[model samples]
Target: MIALLNNLKTYLPFSLLDNKAFKRIEESAQIAYYPENTVLIEENEIPSTFFLIIKGIVESKDGEELIDIYHNDDVFGGIELIKNQPSAYQYKVNEELICYEIPKEVFLELCQKNSEFKNYFFSSIVERMDMLKERKESAKMADMMLTRVDDSILHSACIVDHTMPIIDAITKMENESAVALLVKNESGYGIVTDADLREYILHHEEKNLTIISQIQTYPIISVTEGELLFNVLLLMTGRSIKHLPVLNAEEEVIGLLELIDLLSHFANQSHIIHVQIEKATDLQSVIDASKRIDTMIKTLHLKGVKSRYIARLVSEMHKKMYAKLFELIFPHEWHDRCTLILLGSEGRGEQILKTDQDNGLIFEEGFEPKDQVEITLKFTETLDAIGFPRCKGNVMVINPKWAKSTTKYKEDIRRWITSPGNDDLMDMAIFFDTFAVAGKISIFKDLRDFLMEQIKQHKAFLPHFARSIESFESPLGLFSRFVSSDKGHKDEIDIKKGALFALIHGVRALALEHGIHKTNTTERIKALNDIGYMSKEDAGDLLETLEVINTLRLHSQLEKLEKEKEIDNYICLSTLSKLERDTLKEALKTVEEFKKVVSYHFHLSMVG
Candidate 1:
């Protein structure tokens, strides 16, 4: 009884229960044993008991296919038992199974008495990942960072004496518009920003506010004028700061190195677009704000910002647009009732410009499709007005298949895993890549966790999933010379299908297998590398390859857009410089190598 109580406390909400509740569960629970290969629950079989695995592996198989594996310290049958619904698969004992089977009456009683326990079974929602994880500081110009930091690169500092009033320093910084002040204090030098001033105000009295040095950060990260520009960047990034004091050969404070200026080397008005999106109250205003994104993308790309960074910024802007649009259109009451999610490139944060809308919505369990069908339809239409084309596959929230409660969607996904059809496979791929953009994101998290759990049980799913990497032929030829399309676009390659798709989908498969929950290809690669799935050298090669491929794809789309032609993924091979073509060839080779790696890793040899 003591050992069982301790084991029960190891799981959540059970851990929340008092000694009395523990005693109740212990007294009611019955230990049950089963031989290997025992079928516990068949298809459509509603279990009357909740199971806590003490020792064993129970494989949940859809027909003959192993779909999921439940191990010790895991609970099962809660969903079917609570909903009084048929189970989707047969639960078979893979080994001699030992578990505590608690009757539904006992389980339901505890659930009724404990809101937290009830939520774990029903909602399963809690705090999740932030929409934007803290971002690492990035500079677009790799070679530019190598340039020596000279006076020309420096922004003039607002020099202030230590004796100067705090208000005077504030006025100087404001007047300069973009700068940190170099404060000459008796206790040596320091740097201060308006942010520093605001922080000081919180802790000190009004009279102490007049003292300027009190707010300045002493010996703040600084760099010499002749040091490499990247040195400043590294310092600022490491310190999580924007402003740094630049010093001369004699250690004389010369000016400030602002991160924004260091990155764009020119004023970036992208923040203007963000402010517009945020401040927009009406639908048209939000639509109008979104129009500026394409122009910003062009400007950033032209300014030599890395395509990856541009995509990250664009993804952020797009999410803001989505959240803002939903805020304007959806009823305030429904705001917390649903989560907006993006699919395809949009979902992966690789979306630069879109050929279609790649978005959906996940409603809480109680939400009815009929109640807000018109609003969901209008939301899709409004996005269309804002320049996103309708998805070719109709994956938008307006589609009943895409817009539904988390429970209904999970059922569809479970079916998708079991179906051998290509369309269902495609649907599975799309769903796996979803990223929540707006609403009570817990809705998306609950659904995502469900998918992951299902994927865990379905052992045959990934190998078959990994087989889709073969959908498109490798871009390289017999000798790895350029392989151009023979279709309407002559001498052109569909960079996405030829190169990007294979790399992304391959990485996606590996990520799923390793349970790396990240959606971005680059992030997934880094995570894979960190967890010893891929060597550092291989990971670095793939990352560089992705960067090159993304740059080429974006450049092609931009040029096509400029010509008023249909913007697409095709890259004109003849247009690339010999150096670029060579780099691309190398990148394509890396894709080929990685595909083979994924195929072998997933044992796709047996898949066919």
Candidate 2:
């Protein structure tokens, strides 16, 4: 019984079980053995026992087709046992087998007594697998997840009336031992820090009675109480501000957040990297700053920062870098005349690492400058030089078609709508995800409104748009085994195709149909759920599945980077743990389910 408990601990849900529960399972379970080819559970029969394979391969078949193969540590009959229905497939011992057979009633009692065990069976397979993986590292990540800005607030803010003299305010700051002082005025509250005082003293020669309001920064930047500390760091880094006032929901100031306070909470290097990018003046400086991004990503991941937040932080850094590049290359005057647009994943804010540049430019109608071609070509070349590779399909600003006037873009969009082909539809879909990173974003908004209107009017185009969701088959075998790549690496799977694209595009198609303007997949999922196009449960499952898939892809890319190899989408299954393999299977299953939902809604089968 002790040996059985040890073996059970090696598998999921059991591994999560408490000692007492494990003892209960050991007492309730009975050991059983069967010769090769012995039938364990037959199709159409109610499952009376739940078997955990101890040593053997159990083949599951649906009629004549082999659906799945289960090896040691895999549990069978849990589904039918829980559902109180007949087994969907037949299970047979492929090799001589040794197993623990728990009576159905005993299993049910265990499930009822153990919430964790019940959750494992209740959750989507991907989620359950993820929970199991997280259990191993939850101790480390628990502190990070619990950390909030309020926890890092060190001192009560020193407040001063706006009319108070600078010298008097300084005296209050010194008495309170505060690095920042909040100033109250008729307009609102503002903050003045030591940095502001230093700058004021250096720039001004007046020694007589300078009021706090005159020198203090106006319209103060702040964070809300209970906000994540990591997010506060990102905000401060992006804005290049050290001190932030913590405000409550009622807009009353609660505490002050100083850089030193956050420094004590997180020993993160990403913030330093962000500061370097902000101070960067030239292209080489920007390049030097860019090199630290990969290191920062790894550091954050090791710190247990979630994948979505990492992607967002990385995207913010990229945005700042690109803004700096634009400032360096093009004159400030050219900024307003054109909109710099990011397409695809970058636009969606899901880009975790450097990939090909899918970008474009939308100029004001008939507002072509003499140096337009030269400027656009130089921009693309500089991007390639800065490690953003050029788009292979020429979907960049260097292409005259993509770097067109707003009028010209409208015409192109109209053409796409009126004459939809595979190529045009792909282009339209890509453009739909566009986000203006630098420029008058309203330009992009006007075009986006036009695009959505066209889409709404052409209801017939929905089927064609939705058909792309079915383009890539979910790489799950009939019985939920992973269908690995046949072309390049046999043991690898194209996670982007098998899981990501289906979720992204399926959600995208639905979002477009409902006029949801959000580009991020997670946001789109939520919006769809809010508008009643998708149920809350389905939305959550889809988002969770996306997170799991993206996390795997990011980890795979990081591994490739460590090896000094080019990163690609194919994930080597052999490298994943047994838990990850099971989770991947479940994630892929979610993608298939989402695809069916989209197909049914769009009635894709009715299309010619």
Candidate 3:
């Protein structure tokens, strides 16, 4: 009874439940035991009571036999009883079973008297429904996951020369299931299936068919062996074809895949990740891996690694794995055609434990790769699968706008910053902290040089970018007082959204105004002092405040992950210790100072 009550407590509306409530529920229920092989409930029978299993086991069966067994605090029958439906299936004793049977009326009275208990009951039912639905979807997905090209369909195919004799070809067909053959014709190739051979043999039709080319089918639907199973399935379904010839880039036939073979490979969570990474054998692999970065971070954190060091390791491995995946997918000839460039924190190899993909592509202009679309798509997809969410603003290489030849890319940047607009200035703001990750480092250096040259000469883009920085107001009131919301986040205030983004955006704008491209918030502040962008005292204060906010947000994220809750920038103000709340209040005050600087630089006059 204690175990059952404890488990019930987990689903209740409140996090904590008292011993008194548990004892009350326990005293009200009577424990009973049933012998093995006893029928508890039958399919199509109205359920009258809720059985909260205390010990032993009960089996649930559908049709002829048992499908599932439950033990311990497992609850059954309540859902059916409330719904007034025949039990979905039959329940029986798998072993001698011990349970607490609560009558329907008693259960209803318990819910009416206790709000927490009611919430727990309803939530458990909803959760069970959701779990069942998820199971069904998971099963469907698993079935579709093992998509492969069927070899049986391909077994009916053979590549043949046009000069083969009809009789010899017919004899060959008898030994091999190859009902069809791809034969070289004057234009290209033709396919002749088993039916064509039968017609030729039975009707004595076209014995002089000197070349099987005359009747072979033209064109073939084919894919590389490394193609994603999901994609292969999609193609097969779209084209309504069962067979796809597998070929190497050199156009040499490696094997043939049929729909049945494709469908045989089941989709497991790990399998999707494995396939995505494998297919990302080009620039596309890294791009795809970048998308799921947050999930990857959370998973790693859950495995009990320290946060700070984990970020560095995750970023480096991310780069290395992406490179490896690309190498696997790229045709051998084009392996050295381009270099990947990592910008921002990634370029500096200083990424600490957060999801950020700041990268671009640089390749020789004339390279004009044939598989550009396919290869890059694989890259982006892999990144997404591995838990790196896609960048909403498009800083990654999968965006064609960012994939540029070295020369063209440099020229584009030079033009954007020099001739600024709202969009142009924003683009330059992103490029300010760019750093090289992979590929030809020289191209990135040249691009940077062109950008700096233009920035130095133009001198106008900075203030425009700076002007837009003050859009986020500091969280303080008229007399520099900490403004607490009367009805804000249920019990907590999000320190990140309310404090961090505001500070980071302000500091970044200030850094760009001074042409200081340091990516780290702390480093950027120190840079501001060195260049006289801000006084030493102001820099020191701002840096301290920003660090505190960053630390709090990171801790909050870690906490949320531990509880299996969704993460956001919000910090619960109510849960904070007194010292932490005071620090956040001070951080907001620092942000107010930041607003003044932004306003002065942007030359915006205050209103009201």
Clashes of each: 5, 0, 54
lDDT of 3: 0.61
Of candidate 2, the 10-residue stretch with the lowest lDDT total is: 146-155
User: 180-254 in candidate 1: lDDT tens per residue?
Assistant: 677897755888876786787786685456768888888677788888866766777788888878888788888
Superior by lDDT: candidate 2 or candidate 3 = 2
- Candidate 2's residue-wise lDDT over 97-189, tens digit each? 998898999888778888778767667655665575465445445556457765224346788999998888898898767778899988769
Candidate with maximal lDDT: 2
lDDT of 3 by residue, 1-608 (tens): 56655655543231234566556667777788899988999889987787877677777888865555565656777667656789878899988988888777766666566665565545533243333333334434543445443322123356666777666665676665553566655554455666666666665544555546545556666676556678887898898766566666676555555555455333112222333444443544444544334444444433333343444555555566656655665555555666666655555444544445566677766777777778766666665655555666777778876677767777778777666666776666566666555455666666666666776777656666666555554555553334456364565565655666667667777765566656656677788889887899998788767656655666677577558666666676544533355466677877777777777766656321
Show the colliding residue pairs in model 2: none
By summed lDDT, the worst window of 10 consecutive residues in model 3 runs over: 264-273
Residue-level lDDT for 603 in candidate 3:
68
User: Which one wins by TM-score: 1 or 3?
Assistant: 1
- Which regions of candidate 1 deviate over 4 angstroms? 1-266, 369-371
Model 1 lDDT at residue 393: 89
| Most TM-score-accurate candidate | 2
